[model samples]
Target chain A: MPGFAANKVENILDEGIEKGGAKLDNKQIEDVIKSVLDTETGERLKIYVDTCVHCGLCSDACHHFLSMGRDPKYSPAGKVKRTLGEIFRKKGKVSPEFIKSASIIASTECNVCRRCSMYCPFGIDVAYMMKVVRRICHKLGVTALYIQDTAHSHSVTMNQMWVKEDEWVDTLQWQEEEAQAEFPKLRIPLEKEGAEIMYSVIAPEPKFQAQLIYQAAIIMNTAGIDWTMPATPGWDNSDMAMYTGDFEIMGRLKRSHFDTAARLKVKKIVMGECGHAFRSVYDVGNRWLGWKRPPVPIIHALEFYYDLLKAGKIKIREKYKKSVTLHDPCNVIRGGGLADKSRYVVNALCDNFIEMHPNREHNYCCNAGGGVINCGPPFKNKRMVSNKVKADQLIATGAEVLLSPCHNCYSGLEDIIGHYKINMEIKFISDIIYEVMEKPA
Target chain B: MHDLYNFVRGPLAWTAFFIFIAGSLYRIIKMFVMIKKKESFVFTFWSWKYSLRSIMHWLIPFGTVNMRMHPFMTIVTFIFHICLIIVPFFLFSHNVLWDESWNISCWSIPDPVADIMTIIVVLCIIFFLVRRLKEPEVRFLSTASDYFLLAIVALPFLTGFIAYHQWSSYQFWLILHILTGEIMLMAIPFTRLSHMLFAPFTRGYAGSEFGGVCHSRDW
Candidate 1:
């Protein structure tokens, strides 16, 4: 067995231990564990725990294991054994130190990517197991500082980036004005009641990548789609809280998002290119909020672009001339099942499309989603090292431009490419579509 | 000794069968009943078709998903499970016992073919053991129970092979084989061996979730 090497960097768990350890006694820990294991988890958890044979078939499916030189600790099954299995074996009599370690293992180590679930012969959702560990950690108040802060932002600002209400509206107006250079009367219509689509985006778009909003406005205007962006807080759809195991805040964020759409009375929600945000609305948050699905239909930008291109509303003037490859965002491709539609949109807009090996749903995660990157600057080195497999995959494609639709994937790919010194430019799907699509004369 | 052997071969066997069936059914029911049902938003026309396809994709030996990722293990596991089921149920000796006990018999594999399958199963168990010992990742996840399960699985076949070859006291070895077989049957619902009973449901449910809930392609 590989021993846990003491790293020089101050571990994230120290803070969790200091804060949660003072607040929680052993009895409190046991109470939390008993409640979660007994009430929150159901037969699915029981069955998965009982059925895993320790076959270790899922080892290769994880990028962490691959990138970390096949270290056993990084293996998906091993992570579960160390955390959830240990908890079950101990029956909740674990110490503060153990809980701190478990919290770190659950929050920072595993991305909860669900790739391992694909490889499991018994189809055990190991990500669900990690989520259970995270839930326990959340109850113990041991979540990572950066991600917990992001979750706090979600609670207070209804956005991941803490964009204020006025700043959000101002950013939209600025993007709309910039986009009017192409179509002079283009508008990012705000809260247009009974619009055909309510276009939502993550806070990072307005805060950092406002040009994406500009491009989206151009596409919506040129295609003449009846869409509206909300001026208020609910427009940001990304949910770091969902990743941080703060289901209460996640539920609130989802309710606010859906309520905004309901108030606007849009037929459906069309969100920007963000994978985790798509998962939040379409699956996790909706389930938490007691809806079988989103109250209104939710379509991702990949699907939205596919629809527009298929309907001949968005016509291409020229094919994207650069040799490009598509990185399938895990949530949208595997979790949401938009792989085929995403490919269709890419093939329609790009002249030369080179596919990464193991493309589509089988593609590796960018190591940024699931709030791994949101754990933020303190863990950047760890993130880069863990993404060496993805770096190699990108390099092997030999494509000049990598088009990843998800914002997290884009940021992660940028980090890995820079770290590994790979010569590649990362672009989003809309970037190419906006470039190639015919503009109104 | 005779009474104990008779009990082990007769009432004990029936007890194991009942426990395996009842325990498995209880587990399956508990799983379904405990999890609250949420609404499904599977609106695709191909939902059921894809669910069935996903199940088949994993079910078929060296299926598309397994072939790409785990061709060697898949082949060995497929063969091992087939022999594990077929040899126990359809061997001529087993059917002869059934005929003697219950006035019922079924078609049997030729003795030579059955013998070859038993050997294959023993080899596969050895392979699994070696894998657990050699692979750091596998070893890290494995516990004493895992090795014990493998040993129990291999016990009946090993003792039965020795008895068939008349290498020692056949009567002693025969009793041991029957006792080990019954022990394995009883262990099925309690141990990781529960996978034999639970795999179909777990794998199928995973398929349905991906196909019907996530609307994702299986392979």
Candidate 2:
């Protein structure tokens, strides 16, 4: 009852916000805010702030505003006006309480999904603005606890989940041993220099979902692709620091990940089904490190699966029978542009494929990403309430299974489906692909 | 009274245009310089194909999902913009002034049609003002500057309408129209009206990212 009651109420008391709030004096907050606004932001921020007429045309594009009974503050323009707009108006002379709410608004309220950007006539990216507020929050040391811990992990160990070096190698060997049951000769290659493909994944795969690694190994072996995963800290391609506003840690994590891949001398890094990690490595991280593109070319799993299926490297033995729908992750579909390819793989693996309305780039965010879920348990119910639009989108599909290719989307959709009691089971695309693909005999 | 009217419609009008054109160029070049200093990579990703594609979509009424969804706003916005630009440039009286001033006149709409367009613009401004006040989502984002900007935009039209229709104090309305028009023109570069200048560039950058980099259509 208490657990249910907590879900009914919003998370008003968070240790990270409260503790960070306690230490932040008005002057400190003001100085940090001023420093970020002047130096850290670029032409993009300057243009966006000047161009947004506050026409409120983007009101419908945001999932949070729509789901929260059309709350005015949830509107993307309103959120910016209250937080960053206030900071700008006052010339960074805002209070600690204001910083606390701004942190909550920036970190938990927005997914920075870039969905709203598409709707603006000028294509004003409020997500970029929210991230600016987040950068200010991170500087103020008021980032939500769980996500901050993840950033701290990235700084300390170069991975999000803090998987130890031995634990990582152990997990790979363990998955390799588990997967060898199907093919006696199959191996999850670890650190083979000059391997054509370096298969990279988020830390969560090794930390909690080892079976996905097992599944990936089976696919790689079946396709006869020569791939190697690093045994060191760089194996994790996810960077929570990118979302937590700690760009310094994000730059470090990205550099290490690329270095590990380059050290292997792989032709390309085949990133696993993790959207945010792919974003960090391919888009945001590279830009921060002064590269227009990733140092090592990285392709997301959605596109990787498409290539495998299209090339006849992986053949299907039998298609999945259950009627399934696809949840397009924002980072991949919108950010990475793997929309058609994802459908290509899904249709290849499943007999019955149903398309969710507003599919592809227009898909609503899972509400778990952009460090929203990384803000952790305290904000679970808040997200559940905010993602009612997503729940409705899923429920309308009336599918038996939801196939999400991105790991963040999978977990986020799981929470939505369970919270709404939508009578749909969620599975990764790899799960369905592994089930139906022809294996080596 | 005659001298004030001549001064407002002549020298003040030139001053207003001077500030509008020079200030806009200054703002644009300043932004480019800032980009060069901080984030020059903006130059690396600009795609003319993507930029044109995005601008075209937004230009066409109901071409985007948001525009299509809010049919009333879309129609009002498109009509408002068309009338705002068309009437001022091609009105018969304005063209007559150009002919008198410089022996140059291209085309002019009949005064009756111009009158209808002017009234339509006034109604559209009212609709926007009412929406700003009535819609809570919009109201929350609205600032004093927003309302002030709206009034400044409407002033030239209102005064022009009165002067054209030969309402009370025609000389006063004529002088006021030029003064208000000058104020709005000069405000364009300094205030949110600069969006008219920045929209193309911002939309181009976003379109470049979405199309060239993300391989997706922005609109």
Candidate 3:
């Protein structure tokens, strides 16, 4: 239990406390905790609490524990103890300082990756417990400021980055024009009713990584897939609100995204290489809206690539000759079960595919998902340090390239590679496939 | 003293058995009742199959993903839980007691084997105690109740071992052994020991959710 000294950087929790400290009195904080514990959660909460033996077996499963010099406080069980256990112990009459610490623990410290859940002897969802802490924190308006701002963007513009409607359409048009240079007949269809797929992506794709959309356009056109991009709001599938525990905005965002697909009369939704977005639409948001499953069938980009490769729709001209390793995004592999298919897609496009130790569902997280990276620059040093385990995992592969199929993992890995000087190039599956695939005549 | 022995061996045993069964049933039933219902928007496929598969998957010793992570602990825990359940139910003395009380009899392990198993259980308990104390993560998560439960589980075997060896007051050790066994039985449904009953449910639910929807091959 030695102190884990923070590097020289502004801590988001301290800032959140300074700003949101007086917003909630002791009575209000207690009331919020009581209401959430009593009403929001049911047998799941009670059973998990009663069943945990505190064996600490899940400690190794967490990246924070391993990367931060095996600090016990960073372990999944310790995080739960610091937040939920304290709440139950004090009967929710915790001080403002406790709430501030709890918010930091729930929001920034843990990624809600659920890899620890996979490792729990009793399958206790520590991520779910962390989200419960986040729910309480959200009620008190004590969420990390940057992630809260992203959630606000979801509220106002139906996207995390607040790309206006015209800007979104313009990005698609620009990508379409770029793709047409490769295949003159290629077009990025917009709001085309009855299309086979409604392609959706996070707002960052347009704001920053527009080439991904350009790549998608090329792939879709080359494969002759009937796909459309929504011209209206709801094209962005990412949900910061879900991570922030703002279920109201999360629900609206999900509903609008699904409703957009329905309005377009598309058969299914094909989301980009984003993990949290897939989880939000298929699991958390759908469940919140009383749907046991998503109303529309949504396939992640990994699955989409696998299907295309398997169906002979997108043929590989020559496998990319690089010693590449795959970073399994927790949402898609552990959360969505696309491990085998992801490998299939990777092997099909890459010549020398090396396996990372503890690959697939057992793989370490990219330290980005669950809004940890979205907590923004103030917390970058913390994120990088906590991701040291991942850097070592990637380094051990001795692969020249790291192929991550999720946007958050891509960004997170980029940061890790640069910080650790790991001499690796990171690319998404689409980036590789687009380079190596046989273009339609 | 004769009355106390009979009460501890007879009425107290039956009462503990009743509480154990009833309390366990109540906990499991209440868990199911408390789960909120939701309608599936898409057709759910092979949910029951996945749940059953998950339950069977984790039931085998060292079969879980977590168990594989720590090999030494897995081996020790596998031996410990097997001995924990088997030595109690299949011990020769327990089978004899059952036959005398209700004309019921079952297979029993030999005396020497049962004794060996009890020793292994005691060793495992000590190992676990050391682990809780030494491992910083485990030490942080360990509560008074966690330590108390470990002691509660170890008491019966320890007292039984002493009574069988006739190393101390035989009658007193015997009485303590039976009393501690009854206490463990009553505590099972209320403490973390309830994992004996709920592990299957939690593991199964997790398996079903992952396999059915996520199509994850977590097991």
Candidate 4:
């Protein structure tokens, strides 16, 4: 636990303090200043730092602020003031005490959801600002353990979960077997060249939630979509390297995923229900690799569902009986722009749809994501408390079930809902559709 | 009097038009090229589809529908924009220039509609100004440029309205309008108001591709 000083998290914090904080010798400060602020880009960074208006409109949008009983200091603006503000004011001449506090604020306090940007009259992206703080912390080598560990896995195995190549194949085959039990003829086809779609997923699907893969396969089989799952290294698309700000590893993970798709020569890639993973392939990773856009197109699960419904490839034998509301995943919804289509899918699948007030791009974030929840048990309480706004929104929707499209949102919403003791079932959109859609003969 | 106004108007009109067109084009083209070279959100189509859902949203229906998804702001925004757009394009003096420039004859809205729109727009501006002051959230996020932007916009309208009413023995209301208009045109490229060009692009690309990645319907 971070509360214990000798823990790994604390060690990383101490290391950051030792390297960049005031405890550093004169030579260390010189090195730190040279490394961070001597570049030409430093001028532009300075302008951005000085431009903030100190308006705290970004507070309620932050799960950390809301969860912490509306503590003003936890707001995005306040976090910036305490960390980035101090650094800028001191010209990055921050002390060891400052670095320790900065580490705690960046690593544990913020989830980097861009919801605040929407509410910003100027559309200032506060999330980007927080990420810059995290980047500084990262350069100091002080990222949270679980997410950093995942990034290491991505660097070593080219997948976030350290999923071995053979094991990745076996898992698909295993899921295919399981799906066949539900729909006996169902197949999780692998490496079928010229397939229309190549299905990819995060490592967690195999590591913790193989049944999601099984459901997706069954849905595809029933829809008769020409999709194949890769048998090798690029099979997993989720990249924790992104959240850890390990741009180099993030780029490598993305390259392999894209290269695999290119090798298989699939027309397009369809990723599983993971928001951050979609953002990785679509935005950050590709940009880091110097591509303006992905070489091959990528489609998220929400788009896939909408396509299936529109094409009549999949038919709902009966509407889901439950009243359900949709939780927009920040990366896919706010970042990717899937707000309405998510609603369309929800409406198509469910009989009763109650709009979560402030739904769509304007919707609140599930604070568990952006690797905040991945900080593990030490920070679980903080994560739960930080997302009170989201919990309230979910409760107000008055729906018996919530259909969230992204994996992070699914897990995060589940944890928050449970923590708050809200009476609702958190489900993936596919989970409901898979149950109700008529399987092919 | 018309001749004197026309002389100043000819060069001023061209300057404003040139700045508006060239500056807006430069910003739009730059953003388009940038987005074209970047990655598409996995849910781009879905967002595009929804953003396009209400044609009315993109084209303000005016008094026909005052309340849209954004509520009070939407209505006020529509009024301000409509007045800001129409007054400059279809004002009586502007129409005279139109006749001289292209030999294209058109009519300004009759006094009633024009006055109503102008009043509505001015009222909205006042409401926004007051709202900014009254609402903590709005006040918190606002910058020096934000208040300056509102002033720049409202100054022309206020001066133009005063000149129309001839509220005082003023020599420079029309001149003030032209100067303010010029300032706004020049500022358009540099300010957050540059969103007039960039907003559509960012929204279109970010929202469109985002929809695709989320597996939602495009638009």
Candidate 5:
């Protein structure tokens, strides 16, 4: 017991948890936790709680635990023991301090990546438990400020980044014109009824990464694909509400997203290279809406790229001449099963492709994926520190460039590369595809 | 001593077996009914194919990443579970009990093989106890109930091994074995040992979600 200390990461006082906790009483917290457990949960949650034997096999599956010096608290089972286990043991008679740490452990510490589920002897979905904890936190007004703010933006604007309606349309037009200068006929079609595909992107694409939209336009036009982007609220496919555990707002956001595609009469919804958003539309949000599946069939961009390249819709001008390793985003690879597809797109785009040691569905999460990074500056150091395994994984691949197909992964890997001083450039698959694909002259 | 062993093996044994069967059924049915009430879609999405595949993979030793990561634990756990079930059902002695009680019995493992398995099980239980004590992650989550549950799982095998070897006080060990076995049977529904009862369904549901819904392998 002597000389034991956790590596210090400065904690920032988050107003979201602070303000929410300040307003809450123990009676309200107990009621919220009890109600969510009794009513919102089904056998999945109950059986998982009962079934885990405390074997701790899931510890290594977590990047947080592996990265954080093998700390017990960072382990998946450890986190659940602290949050859900304690709550159930006490029958929801927990204090605000308990709720505050529980919120952090559920929302920020764990990525809900489902990697642990794969490793568990029972295939217990710890992520589902974390989501339940997050839901209770949401109900009791104790969510992370940054992600909660994004969820607020989702409720109001149906976008995480809160890009205005005109701004959304303008970004598309601007990217369309930029691509037009090279292709001379490229158009980022907005709200074209009966289009074969509805191309949706997270609002951040328009807000911060508009060039990604421009690159997508070039690829779509080069491939002669019929795609439409809505000039409305549902244009952004990302739902921060899902991460915030505000399921009501998540349902509303998903409804608007699906309703938009149906109104446009698009055949399928093709989402951009964002992991959590893909999870929202393709898995979580649709389920919450009581649809067995997305009413409009959804294709993650990894699949879209694979389909395009396989069909010879897009021709590579020249393969990228750098050694590259692929970082499989947890949501798309593990959650969506696009590992092989993403690899296909990468192999087509690059001259030299390397595989990370535990590639495919077995890959580790980008700590940034499950809204952990979006918990913002308060947890940035903690986020980077919790990504030590990832930084090491990236360094071990010894590739000149790392192709992360998801937006969150791209940024997350970039931070890891910088933080750990790993010498690798990070990029999305689209970045390489657009670079090498032939543009119409 | 003989009468005590007879009582445990007769009435106490039957009572323990009855409780195990009835309580397992009650818990299973209750969970299914509760799931139907709350998340009925579990029924819609539940696939026999994925469930079987998922359960099968997990059943294999070192089949999952975490299993491979902890090969020692995996091998020990696989041995522990296999020996635990096999030594009871296929043991030459226990089958004799079935033969005496119901005039029906299954094929029995040779006495020597069953004895080796019993020793292996006792050793595995020791490994589990040490790991639970030494591993911080496990220790942090372990309650007094957890430790008690481990002892409950360990004792029957330990007592059985000593009785089978005809160690010092074998008559006493024999009765202890019967009592411990009954205690284990009775504890299955009421303790963390229920994992054995519910693992298949939990694994099945997760397998279905990943395979049927996400087109992914859970294991």
Candidate 6:
């Protein structure tokens, strides 16, 4: 009920205006738009803006709307109508005060979840619309501190969490050591040339969830697959910069990631289950660098695991026996077309599965995704409320375990599940598989 | 008075017919052209099938997703849409035009059923309008355009109801109904109501094909 209230709208708007109440000179607004419009990316942004018809069909597709108790102000169409529409109507002459409000709507509110675009009659991608809004905010230096902090970390350290070079290798070694306790001969196989796979993960693996790295090592080593994780900066695949709309730093982060793989001379990159990172490496980053496709093919862990099972590289000792539901992370399921593989992986690993009613692309978002959680505790209460639909969906599944295939999905789902006290365990696919996979001779 | 009503109705009916035909076709065709312009020209029917399944979940019961989350509202909205769709196509006035245009005729609805269905649709519209105004979340979402569209739609039904009751001169009410109907037809292609035509294709394209790539395409 705390999250279901709409009373905060007026207060949020008023406080936002007051915080950024300084009137902008015409010259400032003119200068900001001029700087952005001068680039080739600006041309694409302009075309996208010109195409929208402002149909409100996308309103219901947003979880924020449902989570905010069906507030239209939280709708994707409404967000655009408030920010980009205003800016476009005013011919890019918006003041700094207006930009501040636009920043909150873009950064903290919309999750770039693309659900609204599905409901958009014209297929106008409102996710892209929000990203462009964030881009403007990024340029105006109005980004959320926590998310932007990650982006800044990416810029300086070439990883979202400021994971240092030595610390990355040390974490891998530590994980390998923990994994070796399971299989003494197991090696993490760092910098191994011509390896069949170059495994990558987001910076958080080293910074927070190193056990995932440990679990993956056991799976890879036990399965006897030829894989190597890089001992360098690009080793971290997660890019909060992509979410912050800092394409400059996003490209740099992606370049480091791909470069790490290419430098290792691996056949391909098999990345961990982080949706945005997958999008950055395989789509946005590649596009930013002017490649139609990733120069080196990048496979999501879903696809990689699916391939591993299909190829009989590993046999299942037993299927996980929890009644589990799958949480679809937007980037992989919708943006990258990996829904089938995700399902394949889930089915391969889980025994008793209760499919979430609106499973796959129609699945509700875990509010912590899109770097919303990265915005920090200041917005956590709001973030928790914004995920009400997701909580309801999970509760409806009546499953004891939730198997999210992507890292961001894991984080978001974990937060939502905890907030609701739904008595469900959240985990990655690799953890379950590692527990049950039969070791090769 | 009859002659004046005849003049107004005849021209307005023709205008409504042409607008409905031209505007709907133009909007549908624009969608096709846009799809053709995407990187790959091929249309994947398999993905389209998946999308169709999801959309049909709203209509057909095929072990599809549940609408239980907002059960009451979903049902109400569903009924409202069905009436809006069926009445426009199968009501007496539309059926008369159908006979004239194609020389194909269908049976008219029974009087009681027709009256109930019309009344239900009118009531649903009013209920929706009231909800939009009374709920703060809905109120924040409602635009002047939303209210204006509702008024435009309510006009034809209100005038027709008055004509049915014979409270106002039948000729004048019928003429007013015909005029409001014409305006709604013209506006349909340009407004959010266009989702009626485009929702299927949009869902299909994003849901099925794009579904494979990302963990969820809800973005």
Question: Which candidate achieves the best DockQ against the true structure?
Answer: 2
For residues A1-441, write the lDDT of model 6, one tens digit per residue: 673444443334433233433544557765766666554233224434444434345667788987876777888878887888788778888878778788878877888877666655445667877887787777666776677778888888888787888988998899888877777888998888889899888888888999988888877876678999887677888889888878888888788887888888888998988888888888778877767568889988888899888888878989999898888887787777777887887888888888996767777787777878887766776777777898999999899999888787787788888889998998888888877888754
Q: Could you tell me which residue pairs clash in candidate 1?
A: none
Candidate 3: tens digits of C-alpha lDDT, residues A191-215: 8999999999999999999999999
How high is each candidate's TM-score?
0.95, 0.98, 0.96, 0.69, 0.97, 0.76
* lDDT (CA) per prediction: 0.86, 0.90, 0.89, 0.71, 0.88, 0.74
Q: Which ten residues in a row have the lowest lDDT in candidate 4 chain A?
A: A39-48
Comparison by TM-score, 3 against 6, better one: 3
Q: Write down the C-alpha DockQ for each prediction.
A: 0.58, 0.80, 0.58, 0.09, 0.78, 0.19
Q: Which should have the higher lDDT, number 4 or number 6?
A: 6
Model 6 stretches with alpha carbons more than 4 Å out: A1-95, A114-126, A164-184, A231-233, A251-267, A282-297, A306-312, A315-330, A333-364, A384-405, A411-427, A432-441, B1-68, B71-117, B161-167, B208-219
Instruction: Tell me, per candidate, how large a share of the native contacts it keeps.
Output: 0.73, 0.72, 0.66, 0.09, 0.77, 0.32
Strongest candidate by TM-score: 2
lDDT of 1 by residue, A1-441 (tens): 333322422264345445876677788888899988887777777788899999988898888888888889988998999898988999988877778788777766788878887888877889989999989988889777788888889999999988999999999999888878768989999989999999999999999899999999999998999999898888989999888788999999999999999999999999999999999999889888878778989999999999999999999999999899999988998899998999899999999999998878789889988888887776777788877899999999999999999988899889999999999999999999888999998
Weakest 10 consecutive residues of candidate 5 chain B by summed lDDT: B60-69
Best to worst by TM-score, what's the order? 2, 5, 3, 1, 6, 4
The per-prediction tally of clashing pairs is: 0, 0, 0, 42, 0, 26
TM-score of chain B of each: 0.89, 0.98, 0.92, 0.78, 0.94, 0.84
Model 3 DockQ class: medium
- Of candidate 5 chain A, the 10-residue stretch with the lowest lDDT total is A1-10
TM-score of 3: 0.96
Question: What TM-score does model 5 achieve against the real structure?
Answer: 0.97
| Decreasing lDDT order of the candidates | 2, 3, 5, 1, 6, 4
Task: Show the colliding residue pairs in model 5.
Answer: none
- How well is each residue in B12-94 modelled by candidate 2, as lDDT tens digits? 98999999999999999988999988878889888999989989999998888888899999999999999999999999888
**Which whole-number lDDT from 0 to 100 does residue B191 have in model 3?**
95
Which portion of correct inter-chain contacts appears in model 1?
0.73
DockQ score of candidate 1?
Answer: 0.58
Error of 3 at B26 (Å): 1.7
